[model samples]
Every structure is written in C-alpha cells, then in structure tokens.
Target: MSHPILTEKTVLLNANVKNKEEAVRLAGQLLVDQGCVEPSYIDRMLEREQSLSTYIGNSVAIPHGTEKGKKNILRSGISILQIPGGVDFGDGQMAKILIGIAGKGNEHMEILSKIALVCAEEENVSKMIHARSKGELFSLFDGVN
Candidate 1:
C-alpha cells in the first residue's frame, strides 16, 4: 500500500477539547485548514457522531462526515487529535485519539482499513495513544509508505 492519508500537519498533540463535539470540530477544522474539506464538514461530522458513535476500539474515535458530507470534501486526508485527557464518546467510551477523516473517494475505506489493522494489535494502539509527536504517531501507522 501507500502512505496513510494522515500527514504531519494534520496530527494534533495534546488537544484541549471538553467533549466529543469539540473534539470533532477541532479535528475537522484541521481538515478544513488543509483544504481537504469545507468548514461545514465539521458540523456534518458532528451529525455523524450523534447518529452513531465513531468510537472505534482502544480509546480512539474515528469522526467523519456523513454521506452527504462527501460534497464538501475537496481532497482526501485525515486529522489526528490526541487528547491525552480523554473525552467521553457516549456509551461510556473515553476516546483518547480522535482520527477525523475526510476521504474524497477510495481514501475513506483505505485509511479506515489501515487504521483497523493498526488498532487490531493492542500494543500498536497503546503506542499511538502515548505518541507525543507527529513523527512518533506516524510510525505507529501500518501499511503506510
């Protein structure tokens, strides 16, 4: 495979968000800042969160826009929000890593699958949760060039 959609610019360290909504917005904004999606994509991501929690396993949450959100994406990429303090993502899941994705096409499934592969191993997920820098976090990602 190739490098995951996540880039150094998109990874946030020690993000300060009080709740899941704020976390989603903060990370989604990174996608906007990268010109991957429009500002409204933030709200749409929140909507997706409300309908169904994106909290994957290992204290991580994958926040993304709804299907309608596709129209807002200009490019494909992911925004990583590392909240060491953790946030409750409903269902009693406290998410420490927020991987916000804005995939324009195949990038969505591709990135998601790669993330799944990484998270499948407990050690890998732990490494990501404790990663303090973008370089450290990027290293934990699997199947990436």
Candidate 2:
C-alpha cells in the first residue's frame, strides 16, 4: 500500500517557474520557505540534478534522492509549477508539473508512487494543470488511493 506524501495543500498549481533548473531550485526554496527542509538541502538536490535529468515521462518530473542519513526520514513535498514555455526534461517533452520528492531511505517511494499514479491520470493531470489555488490543488489529490 502507498501513502501520499504530497497533499494538494502543498501543491502550487501553474506556478510561474520556467526551465528544469528553476523548477528544482523553486521546489527546494518552497521546501525551505515553508520550513519543511534545511537550506543546505537545495544544494544536495542541485548536485543530484547536475548528474542527471530527473525528468520522468508523462510530462511529469519527479526530482528526488536520499538524504545524508542512515535512518528513514519522511520529508516529502509537492509543487505544481506551470512552465509556460515548457522546460526540457531531456526526454523531448516539456515539463509543466514539477513534483519534488525528498527524503531518506525507501519509505518515501510509496508516496512517490501515489503521486506518479495520480499524475499519470489524464483527467487528474488536466485538472492539476488548471488548478488555481493550493486548496484546489489539494482537492485534486483528494481520495487518491
């Protein structure tokens, strides 16, 4: 069974973010701005992105990796950034939704999988892209099982 780490409440729909680098940076900043993560966390994420493009298929890109901890840490967040020009995901697809998942160990995968499933849905994706507020974004994720 998978749990949702990213609730719609945390999602920012149609964000003005543009480009992959900006998307990752914005996601990290949101985490810090919301007091959900440490400032240094962004650097770690940037390092990871430099290694490879974290853009997955389906116009969705999940940029995440394990933190520097031995045990599991359940720190996860989601932000829906709408790139009007579309960011290159290295897969020849422009990404509009940036789902950032950060944590330690494997527990976060469950939530990540849930986000993946929700994003994979055509109806959900359209609604998510058109989402207006944090509340509406959260509503899209409601009852997602």
**TM-score for each candidate, following the candidate numbering:** 0.92, 0.76
lDDT of 1 by residue, 1-38 (tens): 24346788889988888888889999999999888899
Ten-residue segment with the worst summed lDDT in candidate 1?
Answer: 1-10
Error in Å for residue 30 of model 1: 0.8
Best by TM-score: 1
Give the per-residue lDDT digits (tens) of candidate 2, residues 93-144.
7777777666545546676777777887878766666666777667766653
Worst 10 residues of 2 by lDDT: 65-74
> For candidate 2, what is the total of clashing residue pairs?
1
lDDT of model number 1: 0.85
- Which stretches of model 1 miss by more than 4 angstroms? 1-4
Error of 2 at 120 (Å): 1.8
